[model samples]
Target: MTTALLPWSKFLICALLIGLAGPVLTRSGDAIARLTGLSRSWIGLVLLATATSLPELFTGISAVAAAGAPNIAVGDALGSCVFNLLLLVLLDALSRDEPVYRRVDQGHILTAAFGIILIGFVGAFLLIGRGALDIRLGHVSIYTPFLILLYFVAMRAAFFYERRAGTIAFTGEKGTETGLAGAVGRYLAAASIVVGAGVWLPFAGLEIAEVMGWRASFVGTLFIAAATSLPELVVIVAALRLGAVDMAVANLLGSNLFDVLVIAIDDIAYTDGSLLASASPAHAGSAFAAVIMSGIVIVALLYRPGARFLGIIGWISLSLLVVYLLSSYAIYLLGH
Candidate 1:
């Protein structure tokens, strides 16, 4: 029995460690933003987003490099894309005063746009087939370079736009430089714990897939995706509790941005065939689902709908939740 439960036990412990470190990361990130005179949105976008996304990054590398599971690598990245957007629904419900879309800066639409473009590119390629292009620099897909370039372009655009918008104006009293350094140290320490947990996650996931007779694609898309995304879940909730709405929103959106970039990196690490090409084509469902979800977010950010559906979630959140569930179901059916 103990041997049978080992994978489940490892998964639970990794998840526990990730959840435990989330709040500390949040607090330290908020402090770094305050002390460094950076906007909460920027900090959340680059710093917090990257920190929280480390799990997906490492997991993808491990999945492809060690486990030789390209589907798990790709599924984890794309599934995390969908999973991260679904987080907005949770943020929406928790805000209480108004819809989360209404609380965040419209500038986020830029981040959301970039996420859509990147995700759409992957989905389209998956459907049309990457081999059709016959464009490969060695083993990696031609799409890899484009994805990497676009990610940096997106980051540059966001940084400049945020600066021009004065999002980094630093309105509050700044902390001492020493305080900032301390916060950075603490954040790194907490992140190290998350990293350790993330590294073990894929192995546990692989074992679970084997033991349960589940598809690798399904396991990656749902089970492993959820486990890897635990930090984003906790960070967003902690950010909300701290009243950093923009930070919370940015973290989710920025994580999406980072998630897509992981695909390109995974392509490079795969070293066999193209990463996306090796993945189950069913992942397109999740990719397009995430794209639609992002479009909903853009509309909500623009429309700022105030009315809640059944006085619980806004119409947008309802739409998001529905899409997430349907996509997961489709992946499950396809996996079976």
Candidate 2:
């Protein structure tokens, strides 16, 4: 009972804090976007997305450094991707005025496609492990450097693509304009709250995993990931409600892309071997799941189907839900 209370209480508090942080972050970020003369999509992709993704960053590093559970970190990264994709299920449903995809700019396809590429890279690296030759400089994969490099490349590429895409509509936050410095200050404060909660999340998750006798990957993928990803759900809902379509979509894709980068950070933190080598192959299931859902998202962007299946959401949302469930089950089975 005592052990349960710790994670549960922390989880409840952190989850609520992240939920509160979401709208504040998004609003401040939107004002920052306007002030900086950048598009809301870009702000959502970089600033807001990074702020929300802090949990994964903190949780992954904490899991490796403090908890010695690199697999949990790995699971959180992959599982967070799965969970972020699942958020679109709600995004689509709440966006009942129009199908979600039709409202966003086509530039998002670049973000989604690049997300797939990065995730595929990590998945393939883990799956091939020792079967392929390792160019390791002690503990870290040579690819770790490449992963970091590729992430920046992906960011720059998406940044330029969106720049060229031109004129993304940012539904401004009326009555919330506090000027540039004030917005920056507010964004940072809320971000700190989010990050603080994020730092505590993995510890609780690790304890709960131990108490429950669940595998690190399973616990990380489902529990820790779900907790860390609360900000994404909050921002997505808020963005959708605000009618910032691309902002909502870009946040999820960008967060997933950054989440994969956490693997590189984890690789550095572990000091034992490539973090990939240390984690269960069950994680590749998440990478593959991320790829599959990303593909469907890209398809949704390009296809933009008119019909809402079963009078609710689109085919892609349903497909994403199905894929996530099946992949999660497979990972759990493999983990046990």
Candidate 3:
């Protein structure tokens, strides 16, 4: 009995540690952004997003390098993309006064669009870049460099767009008085905790897969993906409570972008072969699911629906939930 519960216990512990450290990361990130005079949207997309995604980044490396589970690596990254979009449903539900899509800046559509592009790129690589069609540049996919380049381009684009749009607002009772050096220090400390926990996460996931007789793709996508994403959930809620809606929205969409970039990093870490090529094709389903969900977000941002369907969430949130459930079911069927 004790042996049976060991994997889950370890997984939960890592999740708890990440959850506790996550808010600290966000606060420190916010401070750094404030001190540096960067826009809130930019901060959320770059600083907050990267801090929250530390677990995914570390987990991917461990999954590919130590656990030798390429499926887990790929599934976790792509699955987190879908799961983050699912968080939009939660975000929409929490905003009781108005629809979340209508409340926030439309500039987020840019982030979501970039997310779709990156995720679609990954899904395309997984589907077509297999066997003879696969392209490699010395143990890594050629897509690796493109992913990295695209990420930088996306960041630059978002920075200038947010600046031009003049959407730089920091809401809170008090300003961030912490010195820049102090904020950086706190960020690093919180990040180290997340990194350590993230390193152990893949091992726990591997054990859970073995003990439950489940596919690594399923375990990684559904279970491990949610676990690593706990930090984002925590940060998003904290940001919303502080009235930083753009930060919350940017964090979720930005995390998706970074999650795809993690795949490129995973490919480099995975010395065996191309990480995407080695992963199960079922993961492509999650990738495309994310792409569809991102498209829904773009529509929601443009349409800006005011009325809620059942007085709980808007039509956009409902669509997101439906797609998320169907995609999970499909992945379960394929993994099993």
Candidate 4:
């Protein structure tokens, strides 16, 4: 195969591997969840969420350091939020019981709300970076340090709330208890598989964008973003099937929140001017879409919409899916 075909081929293989790894991740998460006193949301949001976000983390680092394409790094991080929110539709539809919104905890509204703020920070910086607004200490955006601080604070807030909420929101049964060593081993093994596929995704993304002469922003936003997020898709389906509904939803929100942090790392790796400033203005669209979609989720969690339409999912799911499709299309046009 020509070099052009190489990346597409590798992308498919890695995608398949990510799918196969999902169930193992879900099962291992259950063991770990039971071992810890934290509820399902806590486990999924903190541990599983961070684990699955490894793709964006590694992809961002590689895009800047190795690929030397900060735009890809920017698109992947911002676009992943849109992709992650869109997965709510899949999670809701796959739910054989009540709508997923009804199943997960109301506490997730805090997560969704926090996500909106983080994405908004990104959007603000992207637009500001376009002009002479250089709120920077050095090569980095000043917002980078502030965002890092906010992320930890948000995490602490979420942790306290979930811990106090008890199991009222958790739908899944705790897994059978295992020795701590066994749980640790299983968690590490499953995480390793996910990390392996995640690490290779950026290479395929850069090559395909170059061969097709497609903008890195477009390729990263849609193709690379969706591809790297395959783990979230798999884990959501697996966790829901295993009766861990909160884990499924919490994982998405946590990952989206974490996705923004990748930008800070990208800023450091780029070695150029501000990474956000280096990105096309089109990325603001993705960041804005994240805010809007996260609003939809917060509404669903607060309202707990009982009404289902357009098939298996609820109205929130449909609305979110539409917004994402429109946003992706908008990104495409902007790229052209």
The candidate that achieves the highest TM-score relative to the unseen native structure: 1
Model 4 deviation from native, Cα RMSD in Å: 2.6
- Best lDDT goes to which candidate? 1
Candidate 3: C-alpha lDDT: 0.89
lDDT tens per residue, model 2, 1-336:
886787778778878887789889888887787776778789889998899899899888888888888888899999999999999988998888878888887788888998999999889887776545556878788889888999999998987776566643344333344588899999999899988988888877777777878877888899889888998898988887777777888899899989988889888987777788778877898999999999999999999876888879988889999999998898888873
Please give the range of 10 consecutive residues that has the lowest summed lDDT in model 1. Answer: 127-136
TM-score, candidate 3, is: 0.95
Candidate 1, pairs of clashing residues: none
Q: lDDT rank, highest first?
A: 1, 3, 2, 4
Error of 2 at 239 (Å): 1.0
Candidate 1 segments exceeding 4 Å error: 1-3, 170-172
Give the distance in Å from residue 310's predicted Cα in candidate 1 to where it truly belongs.
Answer: 2.2
Worst 10 residues of 4 by lDDT: 168-177
Q: Candidate 2: which pairs clash? A: none
Ranking by TM-score: 1, 3, 2, 4
Question: Residue by residue across 276-313, what tens digits does model 4's lDDT show?
Answer: 88888889999999999999999898899887896577
Q: Tell me the lDDT of model 4 at 192.
A: 80
Q: What is the lDDT of candidate 2?
A: 0.85
TM-score per candidate: 0.97, 0.94, 0.95, 0.93
Winner on TM-score (3 vs 4): 3
Give the per-residue lDDT of model 1 (tens digit) for 28-146. Answer: 99998888789889989999999889889989999999999988887888899899999988888888988888888899999999999989999988766556674678988888899
The superposed Cα distance between candidate 4 and the true structure at residue 146, in angstroms, equals 0.7
